[model samples]
Target chain A: MDISPDESIFLHIGPVALNATIVYTWITMAVILAISWLGTRKLTSESKMSRWQNLLEVLILGMKNQIRSISHQEPDKFLPFIGTLFLFIAVSIIMSIIPVYQPPTGSLSTTAALAICVFVAVPVYGIAKHGIIGYLKYYLKPTPFMLPFNVLGEISRTIALAVRLFGNVMSGSIIVAILLSIAPLFFPILMQALGLLTGLIQAYIFAILSVVYIASATRVHEEKEQKFEENRKGKE
Target chain B: MLINWFTVFAQIFNFLLLVFLLKHFLYGRIISAMNVREEKIASRLQEAEQKMMDAEHERDLYFQKNKENDERCAGLFASANLEAEAQKKELIENARRQVDEMKKRWNESLREERDVFLSNLRKRAEKQIYIILGKIFSDLSNTKLEQNIVETFLGKIKSLDHTERNHIKVILKESYNKAVISSTYEIPVEQQHIITAEIGDAVGETVEIRYINSQDHICGIEFKVKNYRIGWNVDDYVKFLEREVNKTLEEELAG
Candidate 1:
């Protein structure tokens, strides 16, 4: 009773000592892969959905609907990348129930990497739809002098999105681990529920914020570019 | 904070693979099969409608042809009836002509037979009369005297008038009394000699004797200035007509 099962976890990486969290991470990955395979294989449009398909469909729909509602633009293209991000974060956060389980989203590396992916994808899609010169016109809106502040604001929002998910998920993991170490059993349930709820909230926030960023970047510029291209064709 | 990049990367990659698999296998096959079945049903319905239209067109052609044939048959029937009626009329007319020709031929033969029979009868009557007249007139040849009158009263003229009506009647009456009538029933020899001189004597009047079928019969007048009347009776003519008709009928029936 003196030594806890939670502390016994350690990793032997050729000479370095690492915690047992790696095992839990590997197990979570296996769970996600198995679920994805089965869910995809069993997918039926008319039949009842599996838990994995339901989760995926819901997360994708939420992102799409929110993006469409905000910008009134087609949002289905943004869904896959956003849905992947949501699924990764959700699985990571839900694994916090294990004593050594900590979400990858807690690390600045993981959240920033995802944020950067969303960050780069938005501009890439925008430039693909609208030319470089046309995309720049979006920043010139309200005034050309407002470009510096607008660029700063956009970079800051990307940073905020990353940090916010990492903080929330990491905080929930730390709180659960500390509480479980102290009370051990009955009290851990309370921490687990809190961690689960917080994990879901963090996932939703990350997905929606990323969709908003991408939607803002790509939405209006593409419209004006279409009209411009049409006019150029007419002039020709 | 714990970071498990391996798990995070694995899960994302797995989800992407699943989406691709579903797009290729499951949804693709179901949608394609549904479209093919729908196209088959539509084509079958179209074929059935086309067949129905073709059948209706064929039926109309058949019905139209049948109507034409019926009309042609009616025309043929009417033509046949008219042809039959024409042939019947021609046959009736031919029968009438034949009957008329037969009646004409029969009348001709009847007249010829009557002439032959009447000539025989006249010869026989002549023979009988010659015998009777010879007995009565043999002694009176030199005397040649006779007179007769229908009216009992006579008037004599002071001078001779040859154009008097009474004198013609008196001459005709004297010839009749001498040759045809007498108190001793004697025929005058002079009247006989006069009758022999003329074939059908004219003595101011003519006498007609009708036979059954002959155009004329013998009529003679013998008188010094008038002639006696001589003609066959209606009863004798009727009997002669019946005898000749019966003879022709018997010959035709025998032949």
Candidate 2:
């Protein structure tokens, strides 16, 4: 149950090890706070914020517009969870740089907890917009024969979202750690930069996929499918 | 580096609290402010349009009142002209009447004066004729049969139609006038004189018996008739009066 971050020789306390991860975590949090503040300081509908501001705003606006495009209901209502998911994944992966540091996202347990939170919130919002009875109906697929398969598909897809982010971030951190130890100098910086790219990509995918999943659970995806089916029937 | 369950849970709680505060305070206020701004701009535009319409109405009222005033002035001018035309006609009528009345009065006065003048001339002629008769009788006194018999004899000679009987009366009674009355008996050239003189060329009466001058009293007198000087005496005087009387009569009749 105990973990040592980045395989560094570290001093130990009762349950935790104070290693390079601790120091890098603080730096990463500072970066996130400063960047998020700058993004919100001047908000205009038409213009773009700069640098880290642009990165954070893109994360927020991308998720917002995506949720809105899918659900057609109040997408901004989900901006808080979506913004948190985006920041957490990105900051964890970016912390792979400091010596003896590790990304928290590589842990399945962490990804699973986030996925459970999303699962719980989706039903809550659905029950709020549409009553409890309306929320349960979404589990039964439009064709009764497809019900069992559709339910299994929904649960499997959520599990897939969590596992995918966990495996990719963990593999990237371990590979780069192995490569840095082998090459010892120039290659480690190259591997570190690659790790950063992998980190940002994983973060964007995780946040985007989470919004789409919530959008589906609220019957937003089902409604779109119903219309598409009708259009096919009309054309035929 | 490693999992911290308590810290992870605490972080989640903080994130939820942050979202709740933002939703209630910031988002709600910003949206409502935008709505209020929209309403204020709309109201200001509405007020501006209303004021412009009011200005147009005022201009229409002003022009209408001005048109009414101009019509009133024209009406007054027309009334004054009508009054002046009436007065001008009245003056012309009065002038024509006055001219006619003045002409009538002038003509009447002139006719009366002419009548009086002619009557006075006739009376003077009659008096001169009597004076001539007395003078003839006195001159025939040596063979006088009284003046009444001479007048009766002259009257009888005038009633005769032939010159022979008139001549006989003239010779026997010795009438003052011995000229023949017949057309064949021309006037004796000796009894007529062409006196080309004013009063300074006058001579007195002449004696018929001697065919000579008698009285040297009246001035610029000529003895035109030999039997009884018929010059500026009674007969000449009476003849002049007769001609003047005739001219006056002609003027009165013509007028």
Error of 2 at B114 (Å): 43
Score residue A178 of candidate 1 by CA lDDT: 79
> Clashing residue pairs, candidate 1?
none
For model 2, what is the alpha-carbon lDDT of residue A13?
Answer: 75
> For model 1, how does the per-residue alpha-carbon lDDT over B113-210 read when each residue is reduced to its tens digit?
76676566555554444344444445555432222210110112112244553554465565552333222223345543443333123324442211
Model 1, DockQ value? 0.05
- Candidate 2, which segments miss by more than 4 Å at Cα? A1-63, A95-101, A143-147, A221-236, B1-255
True-vs-predicted CA distance for residue A48, candidate 2, Å: 14
Structural similarity to truth (TM-score) of each candidate: 0.43, 0.45
Candidate 2 achieves a global lDDT of 0.56
The fraction of reference interface contacts (C-alpha pairs within 8 A across chains A and B) present in each candidate is: 0.03, 0.03
- Name the lDDT value of residue B95 in candidate 2: 74
Error of 1 at A82 (Å): 0.8
Model 1 residue runs over 4 Å out of place are A1-27, A42-71, A223-236, B1-255
Give per-residue CA lDDT, model 2, range A1-236, as digits (tens). Answer: 12323234255677665443343444555555555556545543333335544555455556667767766657667766776677767777776675645665665545655665666677777787667876676666566777788778767876887678777877777776688668878887887788789778988787777777776666674575578679999999
